[model samples]
Target: MPTDPRLTRLDENRVRVNNPHGIGATLFANKEVPVESGAVTELIEMLALQNTARQFAKAAPGSFDHDPEILRVAVTPDFHKARGIPVGTVLATRGYMVPQAIGNDINCGMRLHTTTLRPDDVTARIDDLETAFRHIFFEGGRDIPMTRGQRHAMFTGGLEKMLSETRRVGEGLWPLVRELGVADQLDRVERRGSLPAGRVFGLSDFMGEEGRLSRDGQIGSIGGGNHFVEIQRVEKVLDGTVAHAWGLKSGTVTVMVHTGSVGIGHLCGGHYRDVVRKLHPQQLKHPDNGIFILPEGDRHRAHAESFWDALHNAANFAYANRMFLAVMAAAGMRQVFGDHVGYDLVYDAPHNFMWKEQIDGEEAILHRKGATPARGFDAMAGTPFAYHGEPVLVPGSMGASSFVMVGQGNNESMASASHGAGRMLSRGESMRGFDDEFRKFMEQFRVVTPTDLRRADVRQRPDILNKKLEQIKQEAPFAYKGIGPVVNTLTEAGIARPVVELVPLMTIKG
Candidate 1:
């Protein structure tokens, strides 16, 4: 493929894309254009159009007066085309908040848990483990009962509220919270796994009775579209010092959870998108691109506050949701490995969210969609990760090698890194053809789902079986870019350095 004249190679791993519409963007990849050149093109186009709209909004004469500026834009190695904005894109802006930038799945993130059991220990009972995971994660085995007040607290205060009410909410996974000493593990979580929610919006139906504990379906669900719960074994340790500090050892087992707030996120994202669109100046023509900006100033103070409140509400739910999923996974593991197998949180962080940060000494909102925060030691100061820097969990596609990396804290990239290997092929493209390859790949790896294909009852239902098979094929490893190149890009660019590499033993897709 011919190189685009617009792209200028900044370094071995960084490419600078000059955007004519607004501020140019920095792309982090092994090559200039990256593997998904089409997605890169879309990213540039999206930035260009959004920037054009931003300029028009600023210049257009209207009662809606606010200053909005796009400070810096960075693209991670996993860049891929999405609805309005491309995945793996990060934008830093002043005086404006873009709801589409964060996307619908707010706080859709990664979680890593280091365990005492070894690979051999897990492989010995792989079948039994798969059965347990399917039951716990898919077959209604997860019994997370929460009261109206507990649910309200979770929406309002995140994991912090749950920690505070640990003594009172003693049912279902509540015991695991105390047994696993999750309170002590708060430091391991990003922002201590809590974001203050101004108010709970569009979640009254989910909250149960005040005194009784009730099961909420969304609490422990591993939502679709690349979300998974995997059991992995550490394949190698690159940075021994950091690996030791993070309790990662070769051949040891680990649990990786990838999900978010599910429906709750959609609710908040949709609500805010409409709110921002409605707030757009009545006199000026709305931008052709669906991207709408919410201004942050006295003119729209109430709306600005409402946007943050909604964002925080969804973010808080996501934090607690991931914790519950991790706990549920731990519960399943204990059924097979016994309670002796310890599960310690390595790190938990969001890839899709906005951060209130400083840009060149000015207050700015840093929006990261399908990107991970790679803050360095100084930035991570006062936390346990200060010495080693923030842990950047980059999971590869299904059945591929995942990596744990430490942030280099390069402010040029907005202190961010890629979230994963990224997609080389879209889901529709991946689902077609490659039938023989898909079968071979599945034969080599263990992927447990709600359906037991081996059972006669399931096998008899061809329609159901085919649908399940198609879902798995869409996320097959062939659909994604090579993990090796993506990880190398991070290290080469001084964005992040690998601490350890992990390979999956079993995967659970919902």
Candidate 2:
């Protein structure tokens, strides 16, 4: 593929895109321009269009003490176009917060768990495990009941609060919580798997009554569009020392979860987007790109506070949501392999969210839409990862290999890394062909969903079966760029280094 003239190769893995309209962006990839050049062009166009929003903020008299500027912009290897902002794009700004940058699914992140169970153990009882996972994750087997106070605590304090409400979880995966010893694994998670929320907006309806165990539909669900729970085996250990420290033994089983705040995040995100739209100056037209900026000043102090609170509230719920999904996965394993199958959390970090950090001696809001933090030794000082770096979970497409990496703290890339193998084809494009490829993939890999293809009832209903097949095609390995090139780019770029490679055993998608 011919490279776009706008993209200038900086190094083997980094490209500088010259945006004529506004601030240019740095693209971290194996090539000067990705094979999917159209996506890169669209991303550049989106970046340039942000200038409209920036200009509006600059022109507002007394709304800001200084002009708001986009401090930095970085694109990850997995960069792809989304509804408004592209996935795998990171933007940093001072004096303003872009709610659209983080998108609807707040704190959509990855969580990895190391287990003592061997690959043989899982393969031996693979069918049984699939049945168990389907029942727990999709069917009515998941019975996590939470009280009103516990719900309040979760939205307010995240995983920390859930640990305190252990006794209240009288049934359903409660045993696995104690067996897994989650409290001891708190430190392994980012920010202790919690973000403080000043208030829980639009969550009162899901709270239920005090002292009563109520099961809500949203908490334990794996949301649609790329979110999944996968069981994998350590295929190779690239960095033996880091691998050993993180408990990743070759051939041992591990569970990788990719999900986020479900309905709650959508509620908060939609609310805030509407709030920003309403807050926009009536005389000025909204940006054609639909990106809105919420400025920081006494004038918008109340809205700013509410924005953070809502963002944190959704983020906290996501942390708890991923935790529960992990536990549910463990519960499935325990049911098939017995209580001897122990598990430990390796790391949990959000790929989509905003962070407050001191940049160039000034406070700035850094938004990572589909990028994960790759803070290095100095940034991770005083933590267990300080000796090495933060754990970066990079999962490939459904059937392909995933990688575990550690941050190098490259500030030029805004200390971030790709969340996954970027999509080379859109969902519609993916579903168009590759019939033989799809069939072969399904035969080789195990994917458990709410509808069992083997069941007579499901097979009889072609509509339901075809819908599921289409969904599967959309996420097939053929749809995404090669994981090899993506991870190699990260290593070559000094962004992050691979620790271990994981091969999928079984996948559960919702």
The candidate scoring highest on lDDT is 2
| Global Cα lDDT for candidate 2 | 0.87
Candidate 1, lDDT over the whole model: 0.86
lDDT of all predictions, in order shown?
0.86, 0.87
- Candidate 1: where are CA atoms >4 Å away? 49-66
Model 1 lDDT per residue over 1-510, tens place:
137677777777778887776486888876633445577667766675456446645654332344567888999988888877889999988777889898789999999998999999889998889888889998889988878888888888888886786577767888888899998889889998888877888788878777778897898899998999999999999999999999998888999999998999999998888887887767666776667787776667788888888888888888888888899889988999899889899999999999999888988889999999999999999899988899999999999999999998988889999999988888999988998989999899999888987689998999999999999999999998889888988998899999999999989999
Clash pairs of candidate 1? none
Per-candidate TM equals 0.96, 0.97
Clashes of each: 0, 0
Cα RMSD (angstroms) for every candidate in the order listed: 1.8, 1.6
Model 2 Cα lDDT, one tens digit per residue, 255-327: 9999999898999999988998888887788777677888887678889988998998899999989999999
Q: Residue 407: error of model 1 in Å?
A: 0.3
